[model samples]
Target: MTVIAQLSDIHVRPHGVLYQDAVDSNAMFSAAVDSLNSNRPEPDLVVISGDLTDEGTVDEYQKLRELLARLRQPFVVMPGNHDNRGNLRAAFPDHPWLPGEGSLSFARDVGQLRLVALDTSVPGLHHGELDAASLAWLDDELTVHRDQTVVIFMHHPPFMTGIPYLDIYGLRNADALAMVLARHKNVDRILAGHVHRSMQTRLGNVPVLTCPSTTTQIALRVEADAQPASFLEPPAYMLHRWTGRGQPAVSHLCYVGRFEGPLPFA
Candidate 1:
């Protein structure tokens, strides 16, 4: 089975923007969809990495759900710091992803491959955590699917990306997470969001992929004094291709190309 499409930090508009990056969240999401729809090999699944709503309000979640409903295929989701679990459940009451108690933990089968979604959203907090329950569930899920290639999704980056701002908000219980992963050999990749920028690293031998936000992005600043986040770039998504065979899973950083001042797709 081939897995494709990942977008994050849609940060819906008319909402709050306490921090930096003010790129009309709605426009960013629109551009992200345009990029996805125009792609040649359309994705089988869209895994939105998190930050579905900016203010974590019921209205914002409703709006966010409506926008996501416009997508062409089936999609799974988790939450970032910006998302409120109550609001998320209220928006998509009928969704199978509902009732996320700090760990939505979705286990669905798409062909032979298994997709698992883990919740890292902590109420009223910026940093993320898995807790013991989520980690235990993950362990159990992988225990059953040891032979199949499983892909895990969460909102917080488990590995460091060098950006101080994002690094501080990285997964808090990463060691607990790593211990779980160390026991499971079936996990193919760990897909994450929340950095608002693209980053990649390895946890042991497992590949960890961080997709850029569908809204604005933060510049890669390894400098001591970095400017607050900027909104100079367009939105984007990620595409993961996995055909259960000799072929390995592949991921793409898809540019949604949506921004305040736009241009044509080349």
Candidate 2:
């Protein structure tokens, strides 16, 4: 089985403060990284969905690179509203698939899965949208890799999570994205971040999952007028296990900190 560990919304700040002193995102991300590296069955790869930095600043991206350098497994990143494409490309020059300008998107093959990173960030805007260019590129890529199971990773979810405050900042062109996704029968799952909460839903037969942030989690308030608030819930990440062909992919939500376990179920 190919184990792909996913961490999202790390939100590391250059000065080490995030969301108005709610949590130290850098430290939390470090802890999460350690946990993943030390996992009993080490993951084959790692994917950070988005929001690697609280602010899309040079200093912030530098710090994020430093933190990610400690990771043992190979990793890839996408862009969120909180990220700057230019800064990311500058920091990771080796990622040739990342365009120097425009949306940062790429595809990589991980075992039996074709991992596609889609950039949904809109410059100077909090809301996200997959533009025509990006959708077209994705369609072509899916067409070329029709035989491989595709798992899409993006910062913003294509579906609303019922939290009115956050929903306003969700993917603005979800219908367009759904249309592109519908034609791709090989798309196995869509993994996203930005909600800072773990969520599960579907967009046209494809499973979409949002991972919780490594620092804080958005409070689950479904009221129409609900406001945005975050809590110091245990930071977590998601592990996706793909067992080659003829088997379904499985995802597990894992908490970062330590807990007593494996002490004999009998």
* Backbone clash count, each prediction separately: 2, 0
Off by over 4 Å in 1: 15-21, 100-102, 225-227, 258-266
| Per-residue lDDT of model 1, residues 1-266, tens digit only | 67668888887744444224535677668667767777667778777778887777887776776776677777766678988777776676677656544456678886677888898878888998888888888999999888888888889989877777767788887888889999978888898889888888888878998888766678888766665565557666788888778456888776664346545674
The Cα RMSD in angstroms, rounded to one decimal, for candidate 2 relative to the true structure is: 1.3
* Candidate 2 TM-score, C-alpha based: 0.96
TM-score result, candidate 1: 0.89
lDDT of every predicted structure (CA atoms): 0.77, 0.89
| Candidate 2 lDDT by residue in tens digits, 72-130 | 99888878888888898898887777777888888988887889999999988889898
Report how far off residue 96 is in candidate 2 (Å): 2.1
- After TM-score superposition, the amount by which residue 140's alpha carbon in candidate 2 deviates from its true location, in angstroms, is 0.6
Look at candidate 1 and tell me the lDDT of residue 191.
87
Superposed on all Cα atoms, model 1 deviates from the true structure by an RMSD in Å of: 3.6
lDDT for 109 in candidate 2 is 88
